[model samples]
Target: MTLIEEVKAIMQRSASDEYLNVMVPLLEDYVKAECNNTFRKNGKTVYPGGVKIFIAKACEHNLTVSGVSSKRLGTVSYSYDLDFPDSLRRLLNPYRRVRFHAF
Candidate 1:
């Protein structure tokens, strides 16, 4: 299945096609950025299998947490993470690239 289809399946029927159309590519880019693009072998770029699933999950996460940052009901409070989730970070760690800069 395509990435968007996977995302739609993950979401169990999303209400907005336009939102999916726009955000799926953006989330894919985010996943690529987190992985530092892709691994190049013999001048050919190769992507791992996990990336597509990661993008789909990330899209679901983004949809779930969009707009609201924090909330309070009485003394209890909740905070929504606006950044890339740590759980997702852990999943992508194997593909992550660390860059060394010379200053």
Candidate 2:
């Protein structure tokens, strides 16, 4: 399965709010550190782009429809926005690119 799929599986398997609360930050940190390492090695940033796509996909996969539209759960929203890139603002339009938000 893809990384996005793996993350979704992890979320689905979480037992409680505490599990989600704990895992999300570790996931964000892993993604950010991975992105930084990739940027350093390749001289360009691609991991964050991958992370953005993963988050968007994850939201779509897991979000619930409250009424006419869908809204992500708090954990999903938090993970989606964590450490998003700002430089590729033009390429990734429409979606809000969050830099980082620590809880």
Candidate 3:
């Protein structure tokens, strides 16, 4: 199966086609930036290794897109669900260019 198809599957019908397109790219771009575009190493791309991370981030991105689907958060606002899942946070935090600093 294609990479995008994999991402779409992990999304589990939460995101629409258009939103999925947007989010999947964000995951890719974020990875590229974090890895200094070196997703390829030893003649291989990390894309395979990072599939789960990509899907998690894409679902997180869908939350940001206001595409809450059948998640069943609540009425009027799903402000609570706006927080991205901790798994995505754990995956992306290390890859982030800027590290958090505690005061």
Clashing residue pairs for model 1: none
Better of 2 and 3 by TM-score: 3
Best by TM-score: 1
lDDT of 3 by residue, 19-80 (tens): 76776777677667754454566897556445555555656565564545444445554334
Q: Model 1 over residues 1-103: C-alpha lDDT tens digits? A: 6656666776644637788889877876776777775567889755565666566666667767453678899998878767766776677777888877999
- Candidate 1's TM-score reads 0.64
lDDT: which is higher, 2 or 3? Answer: 3
Ranking by lDDT: 1, 3, 2
> The CA-based lDDT of model 2 is what?
0.43
Ranking of all candidate structures by their TM-score, best first:
1, 3, 2
Candidate 1 weakest ten by summed lDDT = 6-15
Instruction: Name the regions of candidate 1 deviating beyond 4 angstroms.
Output: 10-15, 39-47, 65-69, 72-80
Could you report the Cα RMSD, in angstroms, for every candidate shown? 4.3, 14.4, 6.3
Q: Would you estimate the TM-scores of all the predictions?
A: 0.64, 0.27, 0.50
Q: lDDT (0-100) at residue 72 of candidate 1?
A: 93
- Model 2 stretches with alpha carbons more than 4 Å out: 1-10, 37-103
